[model samples]
Target: MDLHSALIALRDPMGIPFFPWLFQGLMVLTFALHILLVNLVVGGIFLAVYHHVKGGEYGRKLSKTMACCSTVNLSLAIVLGVAPLLFVQVIYDPFWYTANAISAWWAMVFLLVITLGFLSLYVFYLKREKHPSGFGFFGLFALVMVVFAGVIMSMFAMQQLLPEKWLSWYVVKGSLQTLGGGFHAFSLGRFLHFMVPAFVNIGIYMMLYAWYFRPRTDFDQGYLDWIGKSGVRLAKIAAMIQVVIGFWWLFSTPIKFGFYRNPVFLIGAVLGFLVMVALIMVQKDPERYAVPMGIVSLVAVLGMSAAREVLRMGYLGQFDYSIYQYPVNLDWGSTVLFLVTFVMGLVVIAYPITLVFKLGRGTLSVEEG
Candidate 1:
């Protein structure tokens, strides 16, 4: 059988329980949230380690703050990741499962690595107060493990796009390779495109940090000013670097796909450019601009996520595959259940999130009283 036919044959005979577009849309939304939290985790942890090693009053304070935030963000990122992954499995089971099967060992190891990364980060966070510089290695170790996990995921994502190469990867010199130990494909440009944003998001996070604490009497105005200035500078530089990486990834795509002219991609690009411009405009008053810029960043991220989905469609289109054409059994019962449960979950989670927000800003007592 040809590659396209085989892909169709591999799809679930039971069909999806809802329309493919709905699942795809949810996947994009959840992925944007997941990736945003992931960026916070990665950038927060790295900054924590860097500041912890630097060891000054401001550095130590910032280090502790970042470490704590990273711990929280890591948990949220992992939880949010599940929804997008499930959506992918539902809408593109053939490609997702095939990619996993091809690198079964790495897939299994991914869980363990992430677990270790989290544990190491927590250990560093808890011990940093006592050991100070002594436990810096743990933070470094966690960062490496986290980055390695990302690399494995990137490899899986890249592999699924190249269905034509799967057979050769699975069979070497006429012998079936069942071990699934090899990493078949990766794109440095694409990986960097995803990773470079971590710094940008983290920089914005610092701006928000300053804004959040500005009203607190305990925080020094000098420190807040330093953080705001530093954040704006970092965000501006990282935003520029992200633009370069974005174009590098775009150029890396096959010219035949003409993604450069694709309207969806262009819209995403424009949103990104606007985000960068907004960051630049906020340099004079990061704390004042923090909330609006945060909202803008989220909208831009959603646009980019949509563009990412479009790119995936283009890649699979080469094989005569379209997610919108997926067979749907249309089980309204399950769909309703999922939506209701999802809404209820948000309601339940909101209370704690609100409490944390208030507590962080030292307003919990006022609200409670």
Candidate 2:
């Protein structure tokens, strides 16, 4: 069979344990959460390094807080990443496994890269007190490692969608080399498409950080104002750049005409605009509007994720493969169990995060409103 036909002929190894749509829904939901933390980690680390290099009292505090947050966010990103991957493997086994085989070494080394990156960040945090120069070097090195890992994953994800080019990519060395770790195909626009959001989300997060702790803590008012304004400035610049990049990314992709006519695309674009508008509105009273602004930002993320899936499916449509086309083999017992555990796991994770904030608030004297 030809490559395209072979890919289409591939069946679910698990024999369709449940409705494919269910897995698709779960993937989108879990992926949305996963990407949020990803933004936090990637953007938090960069911001930490940026603030640290600027070298002042408030900059040091911001840098320290972001470094600490990056540690937690990285861990959460790993944990939350599993669900969507599970769903994707179940639905797109042939494509995913093929991409892995093409660059098996890189796929295997991805975990090692993350491990080293994590350790580097941890050491940076620990050594920041005793050795400032060491911290700077480690911070910059760790950022590159983390960003490299992200690039590897993004390449793999996008590659699976282009099964037509798989064999050509795999044979670029004039032989079928399964262990070649080089990137065969990637788009700068698409990479930036994901990377740009990291800044926008982290910027909003910083603003929220300043807003929440401002009244509850005895932090210097000048420092609080500086942090909040810094966040606003970051959000405005990154978000504006993201919009331009969004257009570039959209035009670069092989999107269907119908998708452009779809409400999902339109709604996602509108939400993106409104997120910027909402961020602008919060300049007067960031503390008061922080929660509402955050809610809107998440909605925007969720909407864009949905739109992305739509575009992905539209691409796969050319191959006559749709997740919905997979047969159903309902197994309610396991499904219920999985759902129950997922919710409980979220609750458990949320408690400590809440406690950290509570303790942080208690650490500072409340600013009289």
Candidate 2 worst ten-residue window by lDDT: 360-369
Off by over 4 Å in 2: 2-4, 171-174, 255-258, 347-357, 363-369
Per-residue lDDT of candidate 1, residues 20-90 (tens digit): 88899999999999889988888899999999999898889889999998999999999999999999998
Q: How close is candidate 2 to the true structure, as a TM-score?
A: 0.92
Identify the leading candidate in terms of lDDT. 1
Worst 10 residues of 1 by lDDT: 360-369
The clash numbers for all candidates, in the given order, read: 0, 0
Q: What C-alpha lDDT do the candidate models reach, one value each?
A: 0.90, 0.80
Candidate 1: list runs displaced more than 4 Å.
Answer: 364-369
Give the C-alpha lDDT of model 2: 0.80
